[model samples]
Target: MVDRCSLEKEYILSPELKFKSEIQQLNNLPKAKKEFPRLSEVPSQVLQQTIKQLHKGWEYFQKRGFGAPRFKKFGQFKSLLFPQFQENPVTNLHVKLPKIGAIPINLHRPIPTGFMVKQVRILRKADKWYASISLQCDVSVPDPMPHGHPIGVDVGLEKFLATSDGVLVKPPKFFKQLQSKLKLLQRRLSRKKKRSKNYEKQRLQVARLHHKIDNTRKDFHYKQAHALCDAGDMVFMEDLDYRITAKGMFGKQMLDAAFGQFRSIVKYVCWKRGKFFSTVDAKGTSQQCPECGEEVKKDLSVRIHDCPHCKYKTDRDVAAGQNIRNRGIKLISTVGQMGKETACADELPGAGVIQSRQVSQPRQGKTRKPKK
Candidate 1:
């Protein structure tokens, strides 16, 4: 359906008109069944949902600058979504589908009584089948705002995370730990004949290993994010461009660090817990001296920030965190003043603040002429 719509839209010229035409054509069951016999077996609602999804993708591409929707291969289309689930008979450990009957579901946790099941999506991962159920419920009580210390965090490959309070977090390199085992599995799989039973089994083994690594990394990130949210009322961090950074010399390391995932988790967790979360410009956060605001140019090898001007010495990551904190405070203060709500660094009880120092010129080195 997506392919047909995409092809028709090319000749139609107007997307709006093409979408309308497609909807009308899809709604006509008699014509649709004659054209595509498979449409007769599938529920009308599911087919319409697929068309709706295709239209949404095109709309997103046009309005939000998203990538154009592409054709999905047999295995690539791994999920079937039912926007509305029938609620005639509800079972504790089973879900009824249109074509497929009630499938057994492993209920790890019980759902709330008042919540209504809105949608059901069945996904296939490797050989395992899983159901993602969306639920909606009314909220009578609002969650209280998070109240705690305000801290700035700096994340990097070396330390994983460094905070303004002089705390450092080391990331568990899940992929790195299993790299050798994964390589062995992959090599063994490559040696097996394609499409053979042994090849399929080896492929599943490799996929399972990859899934385990992904889950482990995600678990680590979630725990760290939750801890930070629970500990801090206002969390500040640098707004980094992961795409640009991932193309550098240490691209592999950058990707392995999963900085983007960490930031996303932190942001969402903060939102959920009613904590203040903001990002500051990352430009000079690391290079600038937190004490005097002097640019202390140094290479990546410089782990310690030794400011020549103010004679300030500290761990590079900690200094960066302090700088980020200061910037965040300034930003909040400015915004608050503009809105006539005087917000100060002192308002955040346990927030760390950097003392300003007078900038001093560094001693210049003598220039030497090249020996000819």
Candidate 2:
């Protein structure tokens, strides 16, 4: 369909101006199935969905003014989406799809008590095939109310993350650990003739290694996110575009750390665990002293935060985390009934104002009792 659209004189004149609907009309034509016999093998909805996916890319490109839609090369298209289902297609041990018969699957985790399977997307990663099922439950769950301990988080390439409570996590360079092996595989692959069986086998080996690195990094992110939620009821992170950081000298390390993915996972986990999550302004988080609230300028080389005004010293990341926590608390206090919900007495000052000049004393908050 993309090729056909590209050949159109109007599309060549202004590709950005065209949309998915125009191509969709061609997909609906009876001649489409005649031209592409393979189209008839899959369900009609799946074929239409393929066009929708392309349209989504085109739409995004129009809005972002970059990332124009491009055709997928051979073997690049790896997923088939069955968008809607009249009934649950998943059984105890297999998932049923239209046109395609039941395929046995090792169910990772059972669907929740009330959720109904709504859609299924079958994806291929290297040599493994997997089904990603989406479920729907007709229930409205309110967002977790701001309460209990509020903790701030600061993430970087050096330390995976530092919390306001003085907890530091080191980055686990998953890629770097296996990079040598990956390079070895690529070198072997380059020696093989293109399109040969040996080359294909070698290519799959390399792809699987890359997939392993991705899975390992993502698993680490989830574990860390859960750890953060376990520490505090309210989690606050700095709202910085890690993408900008990814273009710098240490871009490879930044990419390996995957700060943005970690933050997003943290937010999702916080919501799932009935905790409050938010992002505070990222500006000057490192420059301002958490103790005295005075601007103390420092270079990237300076890892320790030393405040002259208050004679306070601590890890720079931890201080930044503290600032993030303070800002988040202030934000909620002004917008909602934070005083009524929050259990901390020291934090309660003149109209929710945090006294940065005073020495902060750590007080053990009442451990939140679980609901019956």
Candidate 3:
């Protein structure tokens, strides 16, 4: 259907018209016993749902400036949606669909008493079949942690997170640890003939390994995010631009760190728990001295921040955390009363203190004339 719709130039601009035309064509087909037997056997609602999905894809493309919809080949389409489903009358543990019979489901957790299942989507992954059931229920918000401090976190490639309270959290580099095994698997896969049974087996093995790595990373992120949200009432972090940073020399390391995922987890977890979460400009968080507001320029090799003006010294990451905390506090003080959703500024308070003090540059001159 997606392929047929894409071929029509007129349908490219209007998905609704294309959907209606497709439905009309399906309805006008011959009877099941005579011709188009399978088409007639399939439920009308299922066909309509597929057409609705195609239309939705085009709508998304128009609104989000995404690429046009494309045809799904053989195994590419892994999931099928049943918009309407009900509890099986014969079996308590199965769900009845329109055309499909009662399918048994493995309930990992008990569903809430008052919750109602709205839809079910069955998906295939590797050799496993999974069902995703959407439900409607009333959910109560969790209470925020009663006692905790406001913390500023600085996420870095070296350390996963450096907190304002002199704490550092390190990431478990799951991919790096399994790189050798993955490389060996890929090499073995490359040696097999394409489309051969051995090649397919090796491909599945490689995919499972990748999936394991992803799952491990997600597990770590979730645990760390939960810990941070539970320990802090308000959390502040740097608003980093990962895309721009990924084009640099340490692109691989930056991507591996997965700071963006961690930030997202923290943001959502905070929101769900009624904790305050904020992001501050990261421009001078590392360079600017937290105590005296002096700009101390240093390279990445400089792990410690030694401010010449105030004679204050600390770990570079710790200094950055402190600076982030100060800025967050200032932002809250300025905007908290106004009930603003976000606290943002072009520059942190006292950021230009050092720059404003202009010292005269010494030049070579005639010393004799000054003496006379």
Indicate whether candidate 1 or candidate 3 has the larger lDDT: 1
lDDT of 1 at 154: 98
> What lDDT would each prediction earn against the true structure?
0.75, 0.81, 0.69
Q: Which residue pairs show backbone clashes in model 2?
A: none
Q: Model 3 reaches what TM-score against the true structure?
A: 0.72
In model 3, which range of ten residues has the least summed lDDT? 363-372
lDDT of 2 by residue, 276-317 (tens): 999999999999998778999999999999999989899999
Model 1, 21-99: lDDT tens digits are 4567566756868877987898777777777787788788889885888988556777778888667223687878888
> How far in Å is the alpha carbon of 324 misplaced in model 3?
2.5
Q: Over the stretch 1-372, how does candidate 3's per-residue lDDT look in tens digits?
A: 344543435323554553345555455544432554677666666666777777778778879996888888666777778776456222357767677777787677766678778777778776567887788778886554312345678888777777765667665677888989999999999999988999989988998888788777887787777776655566789988788888899886777777888899888888887777788888999999977888999999998999999898888897898788667756665544434432232133322211211111111221111111
Over 4 Å off, model 3: 1-49, 60-66, 86-106, 138-148, 335-372
TM-score to true structure, per model: 0.79, 0.86, 0.72
